[model samples]
Target: MKLEIVRSCIFGFLLVIVQYSLAQEKPNIILLYADDISARELPIYGSTVWSLPKGGDTSDRQYRAQTPVLDHLAEEGIYVKTAWAATICSPSRAMMMTGRYAHQHKWWHNSDKGKAPNKKGSWNLYDSAPYTLEDIAHKGGYATYWAGKTQMKISGFNFDEACFTPGEGSYNTPIATTDFRLETRKINGQKKIFNADTNQEATSYVQSGWYWKPHVQLLNHPKATGPLEWWPNNKAAKDTFGLNTFGPDVELEFIFDFMERKQQEKKPFFVYHTSHLGHDAMDFLNPESKSKWPGTPKISWDGKTYTRIQPNVTGDNGVYDTHGTITESGIHHHINYLDYQVWRYMNKLKEMGIANNTIFIFCADNGTSGYGKGSPVSQKGTHVPLIIYAPGMNMTKKGLQDILVNMSDMLPTIAEIASVKIPDSYEVNGESLLPFLTTDKPKHREWIYGYHKDMQIIRGDFVLKDGKNDWWDVSENPDDLISFKKIKDWRAVSEAHRKERDELNKVLPRFNLHATAHDAPKNGLEKPTPLQLIEDNK
Candidate 1:
């Protein structure tokens, strides 16, 4: 009896050891998604044109973004030559979260969306897709955390924890604590943006500040008093809440804290950081500046350390002094700061001794606001940078990969990484990139697709059909990253171009919902249905 008991105890101990080893093998994944940045904005893509420090037409002034850290990541890992998303933010995010296009999720554009069948509002992505990326991570035995921007409806968020996440309060009420913000109020019968500091009409930017003294909210935080609440509720955050408190910096701090806690618990994590950095916003610190995007706090990187200069700004009622602490306003400054943030992420992972066991991905939603956000011509609106690095895995692809990819691929790629098999009932348009990245796969995809409202955009290796139904020869590189040669006649093109065009032509019909009209109910479609909308011209 004693010998039999000892064998049972030894078997249990071995089982536990095996389970622990399997758990340790699962890597930590961080999805670093930037907002409103085009592929050309990154120095790695080799675009000759970039936005100036101030603001102007892309053709007027030239200023390239400084992204040494991103450049290095792309060099060491793999950067997609062409990656597409929607022409704007909402649809792009829906695509990334669901691994489906506008047709499947019913998020055709920013303003246009499918109506809910049972409710009197727009249908959310959660309603359409079987499960979200967060759900998949959970199924794969991972804790999920979301930081930075939350462009989607807050109620639909399924992540375990969130920090500096925008919420209902962001739009409903003014954060009464800080003086740096712009609010819209009913002035007589018309809604007008009022300068919170001055309580007067301000021309600079008439929206809540997301840069300096940003309006932040927290979810499931240890210090939080409720499930979801406004930040600065805690003593530490309240004390640090001032004119100098940068939102992005606070986001990183919370992420680092979460990583440390998860590490102690021996849990794999998935961090989806939707950084607001590439997007253009009003310059609140230097209100007089004509730049579209506001500047960030000055930061200097000396190879080993990054020293950020504390912002010293004092003012109210439309007048302020920055004390030469803020960098000049421009998209370039935002990109530079993002590079610094990337460095911080790497440093934290290294500190936790999880650097090699982490899968890092960087991409953006849509294109630059002024240059390409709404434009569906060529690849301007849809094209964005895609860089992936999985140091722990034996990824075969390195440096620039001349393949076509899209935002929809992110969900399935992450799902595969988490080792979660998507249910067969759900249809995901994106193909998982895990096998291609890890194995000796020669190509990722034959073509990529995108949309702008009802317009259908599809592209192959040699041919591209734009939103306007115009064809272009995209085989060769052009001086301007987007300007491909217009193909007047299919008969005149080479057999290779014709063959690829035929293949892309066949691919579009499968996704076409006859979406020329975007009214949901008019098309007799319910929530999550595959039917397309038809406009009411009456």
Candidate 2:
């Protein structure tokens, strides 16, 4: 009996040792998400804007903007020539967090009208979504930190530590209300301040807010105050110079600080850095300065000045001043700034000696504003930039994937990279890209779908827009102008799409609508709801 007991103890110890060894092999994940950048904007993706002459002589060559950092990343990492995300910010973010389609998350719009005004509620981050990648990372013995724009209503789930500003803003002047707080919860007989809410001021503007100099609140204790910390600090809060101190730069600083602290702890880390660099906010400066740089307009959000810039015009004048032209160049400048930030982030990774082991993935949340945001434009609305750089990954230097991948794929991909097994109870709409990322075999899907109050399906070079049985064959047509003209009977196309959509819908699991609904408790807030059941007229 004594000999048997000794053998059993030895086996148990060996098992624990093996598990620890396996756990140590997990890769650190860093998601560098850019907001509202289109794939066409990158120089590697064949954009004329990236090749434009420096110093701005308005000419044919001037149309292309400089993005050397992005171009370098493309050369060094695997670039997905075709990737997709939701057409807007909130929905795309929901899809990314849940690994589900827009229909599943039910965050079809930025703000749901169906949410009752009286019912103050937020999405439960833990319930159905499982623990997010951040949550999983924390559980897997890795430090998790989120830095940048966080729009999800759910207060907490997977982050061990986090710093975020409410809503989304431009890169130049970001008005942030930091309402981060620490909450102590007893778990496994230990008192821990695991959940944190950083209190900061909420921007008065929604869409167009300050990009450079703006008011910001710094929460001393983020984990405790919850939402109240976000309230503007009338006495302590101060307006900072935006032009001299850009928002992206500030975000990078925080990220580096977090990374250094984690490195000292000798723990692998996960950083979800959502960058606001690519998104454009109109240039709002003095009228004389604005006139000197014509074509720019001042746009505000929530009654606060955000962006002021004019639109880019094509024809008529021989005299071209790309540098002084605020309209088009302003937007390009934003893109250039984003590229510069990307370069800075890469350098930071290298300086820390964590570049090789860290899995750096850069992507955009959705399509650009003009061509992609609100409408279902092919390549414009769905196509986004995806690049992965990890020396430890043994990934190819340059490769293109033609697969129909979605933002939902990110959750699974990250989980797989970390060697964590996602719970079977959690239904994921995306498949892991590990196979394609590691091998030469291309993963292709028969059809990929994009939905936002309408259904857009892509199959073998053909796109079909579905709305009430109105099916339009938008194949071979890249722009909406041609597709819009080709469609005659909207009802027929919609019906076909609905039929096909219904069949494909079963791939996702059923969720408690009450739990998943944006305003589940139904307090009668009069907010716009997600996916209002369409009446079948046919």
Compare the candidates by lDDT and give the number of the best one: 1
lDDT per model vs. reference = 0.79, 0.53
lDDT of 2: 0.53
Best by the TM-score measure: 1
In candidate 2, where is summed lDDT lowest over 10 consecutive residues? 529-538
Give Cα distance to truth, residue 90, candidate 2, Å.
Answer: 0.4
Listed in order, each prediction's TM-score against the native is 0.90, 0.66
Error (Å) of candidate 1 at residue 512 is 2.1
lDDT of 1 by residue, 1-538 (tens): 7666556545643443344345546889999989999898888988777766554346433366777888889999999999999999998998988889977778888887877655567776777675677877776678899998876676776788898544445753745555566777798899887777667676644456678887778889887789888877878778878778888888898898999999999999999999999887766666666777877899987876777898988776556788999887778888889999999999899989999899999999988988889778888899999999877766767999999999999988876676666655568899888666765556779999999888889898999999999999999988668878999988888999999988888888777773553334443433332211111111
Tens digits of per-residue lDDT for model 2 on 1-538?
A: 7666556545543443344345555567888888877776665666433212122222254454466666666677778766778777877877777677654455665654224234445344343344466755655567877766776543545466554543323222223432121234456897544212222222212222223322232222233355324323334323533223334555666567778888888888888887665554422332113211112222222322123233232221122233433334344555666665666667777888877778888889876655465556544566678887776766533655545677788887766565556656556777777655554433435455555543433423333443233334543333322234345644655555455544544532333242355353443223222211011111
